[model samples]
Target: MSVPVAPTPGSAPGAPPGAAAPGGGAPGAPPGARPPLLSRGRWDGVTTALRSPAVLALAPLTLIIAVFFLVPIFGMTTIAFAVQTDDGGTRIGLDNFLDLSSHSRAMRNSVLISVVGSLIAAVAGSITAFCIAQIKSERLDSVVAVFSSVLANDGGAPLAFSFIVTLGNTGIIFGLLGLEAIGFTLYSWQGLVAMYQYFLIPTMIMVTLPTFVGLRKEWTEANTSLGGSRLTFWRRVGIPIATPALLGGWILLFGSAFATYASAAVLIGSGGFPLIPLSIDSLLGSGLGAGGQSTAMALGVTMVVIAVVVLFFFNRLQRRSARWLQ
Candidate 1:
């Protein structure tokens, strides 16, 4: 059923590939034609990507992070390295990092407080989550979630002021109840940890609640049906499943407590307790103390590094926990 077909004028018989046709165009093309500058498919792909829902949704957040977080971090890192000169100038140097030796006590205090507070919050929060799981009321669960959310976000000046009113000198507990007889004070190291607990425990609860609540009742029931005791069920299944979340929550709490400055600033107010955050504040805020602004920035940079490390481990543990939870 073959029919005689006429060849295009430009595509003549025995024509060489890519040879110019009669009207100054490539073979098989019309006269005076040009190739496309960009591939239509590639352009369409780019257009589709621009119109993607995920990209559009993330645009604002990406801009905000770039402007606020990344930009400031870059500026801070630059300032951290830019050592002040005696001639009232700046030079790129490690003077600030070297000056960190003077603040060893602050470093030690920061590590101690963050570690102890996070550990305590982890244990206490786990217990609280378990207790909360025992409650079957949906309303109570919602209430706890809301309460934990609110308290987890609670800190800074208001929290400090509340603590001051409740525990500071001339306040209710110490002033009226005479609890000061036991040598209790809100401005001490122990009190700082207590203040950290005010929020960290709730943060832990927020992190652990889902895991605890979502624990499959059937697993425990099967264990019990298999002649296992309640304690044995928990000892084998509960602890193993919950441990990752607990560790991740602990690391998160550690970072939170480590970076905390507002509440501590208001409550301690340049007190004897030399925390890393407080030290940075003092060094930078006090007209550049012996360590100077660069030193404060260095401390800030150190915190950023520690936070990054903590977040890395936390994410890994969260992934591990997610597997078990799922």
Candidate 2:
């Protein structure tokens, strides 16, 4: 007399309920012991996607940039080259680019402010960042860091407004120093440089503080043990290791000043400063509106290109600068 065998859960479906799966497990292997290859692959993929710290951290930023920054860059670049046909149909052409050359003075001024302001800011801010990095008191460091954060973002209207009050003719600082007697005004190129440094310094400081803090004391001690003076160590090891960070901060400041609109606009309102942002705003507002829209878009596209270039520089610098630090 024989009884029929039942296949176990791990067996082939067609096998007896309690019988072994001939191609796979034994007579009574646990159902959960090993999933099929396809199922395992899917689970592994899901777990990897979930557990990756880099993906988790960058996902939100990537989404935001894709939606906001990249989409707008495409739209703006399209508008820059768009031309209206006789029947009002739009097509891409070089008319806007030809006209963009007419904005040379504004371009020159924008670059001038950005370059000069960045240099001053990078130098001044690095000095301040070095000082901040050296403070042994965590509380004092926190307070200074808070102040730097406030100033770095204290751009636009508030900054311009404060400068106006202090640097304007009737304001307290101006009245006290009588800057007007020596012929000073906050509406000219020189004044704009000063005004731009207000934000640029803090921006540089914010970017540079980390580099200063990352400089290891052991390296300096090693340099000194090698018979290098403090000045020699700084001039050679310290500065060489830090050049990338400083240069990155400078480029950042330049981009900030170049794209700045509100502060410059407010400070030089109706003063005919040939800044790119002001020209764009004016073109959008004045009787030139219809004719200059494309040119304004062209300027915008230029700014986007510049910003992307700066970002590329920072990334490349980080990779290469690692060797110097090591």
Candidate 3:
């Protein structure tokens, strides 16, 4: 019916104004109208590309882990379960594990040593870290960090030898201060724990230093502004934020001490020490006994399982701690 409409501005030469485009909504379509297929396809392609960077970045690490870690673990697990025959043949069975049960004392000793040493390291390290954080000198912090890293990595034969010459019976401390007179011997489980502290405490300090440093002055000021005492601030705010990191560091220290071999072996020979690592060594070289490579592999497998669980909890705790740090 029949009013003539003026040609819409910028309309196609021969097309009516307000008409739909060839493949989509009208050029002047409402905001909610679907985009053209080409545009949509472009966005889909962009979304796909966005998902690829993380995968690509992680590819090398994943390949290395599969080849080194997973492959070794698979071989070890198979060996752990394989029984050796009198005729020098191997067959899949649980004989190694069954034999390992007899070494429960070694397991218990290892757990006790690791747990106690790590706990001591955790407390000592946390205190040290807290003190270090309070100091405003970046130079001092860097020095301490460098020393800690060096000491943490310093283990094995040289460390064992140093401990012996310095703390052993008739060693330097004994000669100078007569520490032996005090009935202290660097050859017992107590000595092992002491040796662990030389490394574990340094490790704990490194792990905890960052968390303590991240405790901003504003946070303390905020708590004080709320009429909280220093004690109250730590009780409510500081401890809560740092707890996850502390626990995670402690677990890491425990794992380190648990898996240690060379230092313990050198300081206290496998024949004397009943720790799992020492037991593994003894079993592996036993030659003509039930304690052989298979049993050693079984112990190794047990350690691997424990390490997996420890790492899982450590990662979870680290995630929680990271949230607060950020």
Query: Which of the numbered candidates is closest to the native, going by highest TM-score?
Result: 1
RMSD of 2: 11.8
**Better TM-score candidate (2, 3):** 3
Instruction: Give the clash count for model 2.
Output: 7
**Which ranges in model 2 have alpha carbons more than 4 Å from their true place?**
1-72, 84-91, 287-289, 319-326
TM-score of 3: 0.75
Q: Write the per-residue lDDT of candidate 1 for residues 126-228, one digit (tens) a residue.
A: 8898799878667877899999999998778888898888888777867887868888888887778888899999999988988888778998999999999
Q: Model 3: residues >4 Å from true position, as ranges?
A: 1-70, 83-93, 288-291
Give per-residue CA lDDT, model 2, range 221-311, as digits (tens): 8988899999998898888888888887887788888888888888898557889888878877766456777787888878888888988
> What's the TM-score of every candidate structure?
0.77, 0.74, 0.75
- The ten-residue window of minimal lDDT in model 3 covers 1-10
Q: lDDT for model 3, on a 0 to 1 scale? A: 0.80
